[model samples]
Target: MAKRRKAKQRESRAPRFWGQHAVLAALENPARTIRKLWATHDAIAGIDVPPDLQVEMAGVADLGRLVPQDAPHQGLVIEVEPLADIAIEDLLAGAGDGRPLVILDQVTDPHNAGAIMRSALAFDALGLVTQDRHAPPESGALAKAASGALEILPWCRVVNLARALDQIAEAGFWRIGLAGEADMDLADALGGKRIALILGAEGAGLRPNVASHCDALARLPISDRIESLNVSNAAAIALYAAQNSQESR
Candidate 1:
């Protein structure tokens, strides 16, 4: 009796997470079992929720009670576990048709990372590659920023980024790093059977060795007035350019 009572208590105390990515992912994935859903009035519109699933309609403050203080839940939260990671070998082997990949070099900001994931999905990117230590963990802010893209795209974290770039190069990818001060524009430098768009930290840019690993460096054709564009925005533009270039070729 005590054991059963303790289990019930633990179940009740479990918190729900919010953000479109987190909620929508839970809904889409059959393996992700949802305990309860707390949604804002505006967010819950035009959805047929399962009758058995627990539903709570509440405002931001009520939603805040479920997650950490800093979580940007955006008025929707669903309790769930983390997704599994895919092996590098599998991802590379599947890169058979020579689709483009976006390699993230130490861009750890969750909002930025999440936004990149969203863009990657939008352009049908192969996958997002990030260094394990430097990448952001899956969280509410990331999920919120992803806006449901976190579920579809595979975010792979590797130990050695340089070696990973080498593997990518050996696999027939023309690695192009996005730099503000590069001599060539992005469209001019995109030449290959497969392309890996390498992006680095916002202010710091790509590391020297990482840049050297790439076959070429390219700059976005943007205003000379501004020094740089936001990292995620730059990624979206680069992905779009790469996909377009691939299609043209």
Candidate 2:
């Protein structure tokens, strides 16, 4: 009964998801709970909204007010319960030559995390893992930045990232940490092994202990055009390189 009440409370405070990408993605996810929806008539014209969900017709202005200021709602917004927490063991269990995993260390910015989620899905990653306390919570901005990947991708949060790394290693993953200061290039770090790519927040880079947990540290072969790439961009590049390496092998 207490758990049921907690679930009710959680459902009541569902995050508002705006923009067509975020809203449609949430709608399509079987695991996602749609609490309330406010959308322009045109936004629902061609879309098939769930019969059980209550959708409130509204004007563009009404939709705008439902989300953050100046947020591009794209004429739709929906209050949705965040997906259930995913277990790291579940991710590791599928760690066989399946998609590589991307782990973030202290990537607290929702936008960066969302973009990394987007990239992870694009490159067919197994899942994204983040340290629970150092990661961002589910939010409209994050959903928007993910561009629907939030709904499709498996995102796991763990209390102990170092311990999770140990489990990943035991699952036969070749953990590679991406650092700008690393000596070896990212390509050199890749082989025929199932990869677990680790990226840290921009500027700060990987935490010392987190870097030590990885099997190898690699740097992207970017020229002196810029000092470093954003964490999200770096994630995309690393994922692509890892996936490409697998295909060749």
Candidate 3:
């Protein structure tokens, strides 16, 4: 009885996804379990609702109150259970196609993480990895920034990033840590190996232990005038470089 009550409470507190793209994506994802949906008539129009799902129609003004004051909810909101966590081992085992992977170390910003996921999807990367303790959970801001990529991208959160790096290395992936101070250009470092691009937070790049775990440290070729690129921008460029490099060989 106690366990059941606790489970019910937890379910009640699940994240509410808003915005047209976020809510629509969640609705389309068969794996996503939607608890409730609220939308203005205009917002719900053209969006196919599941037959068994519960929905409520409300005014745009009322819909605005459901999310952050500044959030662009687009009159649609959904209460959904978070996606189940994926195993790093499962990701590696299914790496026969040689798709690259992205690993984020202590990237706590939801917007940055979401943008990275968008880039990962754009480049057809296998998945993304982050330290469970340091990463952000599913949120409306993240989903909005991702623009629907969040629903498609497989995200894995692990206990120890260094240990996860070790497993990635053992899986025949050439782990390349990105740092502004690195000598080798990202393109030069890529010798057509199945790559796992490791990135860190904005100001402080990869930590010592994380950098040590990587097979090589590489940098993007940019002007020395700027300190460093935003993590998401760096990720997009790296994915493009990796894809182009592999195709050229």
Candidate 4:
């Protein structure tokens, strides 16, 4: 039917994920829709895919042609639709006491976002919030960097990050902006039952508007030997610090 043709057209243009983690995660996520899957014989042997789903057997070279150059597909590639969007309200509604939130401002790089997602999942953070216009779309590079975190993490894209921060505050989250210029330390800012950790894009740092929305601004305790840590690394450290702070109390 016409609907099936349109669906096929959408799948043709949709993103293709490769690698064992990314492909397998996509397959495992019920929210994900896999259109076309191709895998090498050796790779397929270890995978227990749905019996009803048609899978194409391919060689390593054939799978290589499906993804970006030198992407390390690990003998798998699959066409898929982007996961459905999550509303910020729903994200906040799901937050529990002591669970942290990671909010990104203008962090456009997919690698950093992916790594942050990985950290958020590792720390059991409530969710990730980002400006809809400033964040990268789901892609193979991101999924690869996240190591499967992208499929499971609750991600919220909003029109205005500052406005979203206000909603976050109204929901009883004490917002802490990670600003190198702030005199406050991250540990001191973790006073509330729930914490909302905000980070910004590298180089530019937090915008004035977003910074204004924060309840307090805190910086990581890093030596001057390095100007600053990578956003993802900083997020991991901060999340770890938050966890320790919560557990010690």
C-alpha lDDT values of all predictions = 0.80, 0.87, 0.87, 0.86
Q: Which lDDT tens digits does candidate 4 get at residues 20-115? A: 999999999877788889988888886889887779999988888888888999998988888777778878887766789999999989889999
Model 2 poorest 10 in a row by lDDT: 1-10
Compared with the true structure, the alpha-carbon lDDT of candidate 2 equals 0.87
Tens digit of per-residue lDDT, candidate 3, span 189-230: 897679999999999899999999999999999998987899
Give the residue spans of candidate 2 off by over 4 A. 1-12
* Better model by lDDT: candidate 2 vs candidate 4: 2
Model 3: runs farther than 4 Å from truth? 1-12
**How well does model 1 score by local distance difference test?**
0.80
TM-score versus the correct structure, for each prediction: 0.83, 0.94, 0.94, 0.93
**Local lDDT at 6 for model 4:** 14
Weakest 10 consecutive residues of candidate 1 by summed lDDT: 1-10
> Candidate 2's residue-wise lDDT over 176-210, tens digit each?
99999999999999977899999988889999999
Error of 2 at 231 (Å): 0.6
